[model samples]
Target: MEYKYKLAKLQYDKEKNEELIKRQRKRAGQVFPKQLEVEFWQQHLEQARHNINQYFWSGVLIYFIITVLMITGDYWIIDRNFFKHDFIHSLLGLVNGAFCLLTLFFFAHYKILRPYYAYAAMAMIFWAIVSMTWLTMTVHTEVFRHQAMMIISMIYIMGFVLTGVKPFHMLLTGLMAAVVAMIMLLTLYIPIDVMVMGRVLVGSTVVGFLISKMLCTRERMIFLVMHQARLSEKINRIHAEELLHLSQHDALTKVSNRRTFDEMLDSYFEQARHDEVPLSLLFIDVDFFKKYNDHYGHQKGDEVISAIAKSIKDSIRHMDFVARYGGEEFVVLLPETDAHGAYAVASNIFKAVERLAIPHSQSLVDSNVTISLGFTVYKGEADIFKSDFLQRADQALYRAKQLGRNQIYYHTLQVEEVL
Candidate 1:
């Protein structure tokens, strides 16, 4: 039942992820259901940060080279008529470029940068617009001013794309840059055609917005598909593990079943026949279990069995194996154990079940529920058959029953001990 519940939950999650992926395949899928959209971004943060590092760090080297070229151009004048070099405007451009590099480096190295990426993107757009606008005003030639404005337009678009923020954030940052640019133009009173400036800004904003939407759609699809594949693999692994457990474990007692015990016994018998190590088997049966069930009810009998199984498990070492051999009977296989070790383990198991103190008035052995244990250890002997070794343990169990129940009997080929 526990395994069933877990398998069901995994299936549901897998279906849900696939559904989300399908929804995203449509045109309007960019806008996800509110809470899920938030979760998506949170999960994508590591990838987002990595994309930022690649773009912004690369921008750092580009900007540094631009700064160097700007400084050199202060002395060299190839076109005096088309380009008027104003030191103030050049200084402003150089500062913006250097500041962009340093800011990206600081965010990349210093702190948790994912949360602040949108803000950093907006800052990149705003500063680039300010410096370029001032430089445009300082230029007297239309060629120089037009070129500077085109660069500013690229900056506005590249800010969001390179940052890899959500489409909503991209639009918001673009609109904010346009609004702030108008404010700067009005206050600075830079002499230029306002109509041309408006056209450039609007065109750049529209182009950037469309590109961001397209890129975001592709990214969202890839993320969903990758995660869905992982979810499917997880579901397969979990289902296989649960099925294997069911095939090998007893349903009622949650211990290894009779089939598992039989397979293990055969393997160990073979090992003992050829190897130097000894193989020990302990046969366990509840005392007066039939009478106990008749008096206390079958439910009570089941509870007793489960409790006794647990107690037996806790009493033995991790290397030992315990299984429900049949109704009200169990078997423990101890590998590499000598006579003394097998005897001690059988003794502990008998005492531990007795300590459970489950009420069993039908049990003639004791007022509370108790158990009988019979164990035998077989040292490697080429002369003896594996069937003979198992028969020895069964014979000990019959001997314990004959002497009266609720006790332990240890028997070997040449010796017998009672405890």
Candidate 2:
């Protein structure tokens, strides 16, 4: 029974690990919608580059100050006849100064710098060399051992704080630094407690590395959450805009539907009345449409209607409105248009339909498909109701159909003052 329990537990752990690995792979493959992945990384790199540039400048300044002090201290030591290594100190100061200038040059033109990972690794190695050289010199002098240890600890802490690398990368760097320090200490023949002090320094570096990894992991988690939230917001916004477009447009004709037409008409009517501008509404009918549908199939009828809608849309101005009112019927609202303009638009629409030249043997007026349009122009009249205006245009449409199928009829609303 005990063996069975252990086997079951092992199986469960294996499944859990597999599931975790699968989820991690899936998360790594995830991408933001609408090219936001590219944009996000671009923005992140720009920000990080700017910050790194600032850090480089600050480091240069600090190096400059420290080099100046080291030069002054070397000269003082020479004057006092205290240390014979003043020449070595002078060379190190010169080297540090040269390095400061090199760092400045690289950061100033970081734009042309290629292979970012290589650059980063090279920079870390350079700084590590400089730090180890200075620390090793201080150890050889044996004048400020306590101060040197404090400085070394601070260097490790700063490495954890300032290096903008992944936790794994940081761990590798820390290990390299520790190994280099251990090698340097072992080679240098110091008459002190080398073993105990070496262990203490190495252990401290390990602790600092662990702390750096924890901090980097937390920062990465926060960044991922924020990125996910931004992606979610963008998706929701695009989905909402798509839904709005679908609601307002006709699925078959790909034009404004009846509901959208009614809303636009009311809005344009109010605006025209307010501005005292002329507004024309055109009621269009496909002549002998039922007969055409009877001759052709319903699918063909749908295609014909769609073509008509497209022609009308192509003929009208952008500011003008056209919508599918119902089967074989359309409405157009032309704001700020006089009778002449309205008549010109209607004529263009007629010509556009004529251009299609769809065969219609069932149409009594012509062997080709044609449309009749009736328009009513309102000249800012508060007395005439919207329904009445539409009714008059509809009446004119009836008259066009009564007389002949393919033609245009119009009714102009005139306001007379009762003096």
Candidate 3:
């Protein structure tokens, strides 16, 4: 029973996030949706850049060594008379290494050109696969041609491992290698065994295709799940904050309600006691509000209350605040204020409500809407606790009703002592 709710909550959240990702993918025309734009690109680029940087120098060194060995081997050991055609083919092979280095440099120096890296990387990989086939074309030896074919397959699969943090890049490179290798073998006059080479090519490509399909599936699943968790947590936070706000406020009047007022009362009292400051509270009631609601209908009553609340809230100083204590009743709390300050605020609010001129045909006081107010201003008295001020204000409001309907009254300290 202890961890039951926690496990249930986790399950519920996972399901909800999965559904969110599914719906979002339907709407996502691009690789990354608008909300996850920053995260998606940041992760993708970081992985690509890290791998390119880590392997770039080592891969370049290997390419340079291979290029030098090819040129030197043709001239020194194999061919007694190396012609211009051999020179041209070796230079052409060296050009592929140059393109590889160029791709590395583009990634290192130019960050703003992020969109081009994928194309540049793909082109470099495609060149690596095809360049060896072309380089061995001029060499009429069976051994060199066979060795070159093996090198082509090796580089083809290596391209897959080299492409990091991408979904389809490895697959794309693998497909390109297979297509170009087969096309060159069939069409061009490279004196190699068609049967043996074709079999090896198909085998390696099947492995590459399997590797590509498997890796792409796993990485793509992880990426989607990661994004869903990030976005769902953000959405949950927003909803939680909204719920907290709704709980603390009156939905109808858009003001702080009784629950919030009660919390503030406790806090303000503690602060006032510590600082040896005065605290004042004003309670306001709409005069004959029940009759007003009955006569003018509840909708009009709601409008009148809203208008009166706005007037009261606007008329008060920023330091002093108000809340709807209950139905047609509002409380204003003023800290560090004496009797004079409380009276002034109460009087202003009373006048402000009258000035609204909302036709209150059922109000007993006047033709327009009016309010009766009673307030209590308390110094830091050791004998008095926080709740004493509320009682004093209530008693004062009762006396005001007994006397008349639409006037302001002050519950003095002398009356409290007398009681």
Q: Which candidate comes out best when scored by lDDT? A: 1
- Tens digits of per-residue lDDT, candidate 2, 1-419, equal 44455556545544544453355356643333335445544544454445656666686788779878866765554534435454465555457545644553464446666336334633554465436445444433454454456555655555555444433455566566666665665676544466755654565567667776565445444545565555456556656766787799898998999999889978988888788899989989999999999999899899999999999999999999999889999999999998889999999999999999999999999999999998888777888788877787777677778878799988665423110
Find the 10 residues in a row with the least total lDDT in model 3.
28-37
The reply for model 1, stretches above 4 Å from the true place, is 14-22, 25-27, 54-84, 87-95, 109-115, 258-281, 287-304, 314-321, 333-348, 355-369, 376-399, 411-419
lDDT of 3 by residue, 1-419 (tens): 32455446656666765765676556532344455445654566567667666767787788779878877876654444555656666576678657765665576447776556666666667777666666765465445566666766676565555544243655566566657876886777655567776666666656666675565445555677885676567557656766797899888787899999999999998888888899988888888999999998999999988998899889888888789999999999999988888888888888888778888777667998888888787787877877687898887777777769798888875574421
TM-score of 3: 0.58
Pairs of residues at least 3 apart in sequence or in different chains that clash in candidate 3 = none
Q: Find the candidate with the highest TM-score and give its number.
A: 1
User: lDDT (CA) for every model shown?
Assistant: 0.77, 0.69, 0.72
**With candidate 2 superimposed using the best TM-score fit, by how many Å does residue 230's alpha carbon deviate from the native?**
4.8
Q: TM-scores, in order shown?
A: 0.74, 0.64, 0.58
**Clash number for every model?**
0, 0, 0
Across 32-69, the per-residue lDDT of candidate 1 in tens digits comes to 66776676676555565566566765766787787788
User: What RMSD, rounded to one decimal, does every model reach?
Assistant: 5.0, 10.5, 8.6
Which of candidates 1 and 3 reaches a greater lDDT?
Answer: 1
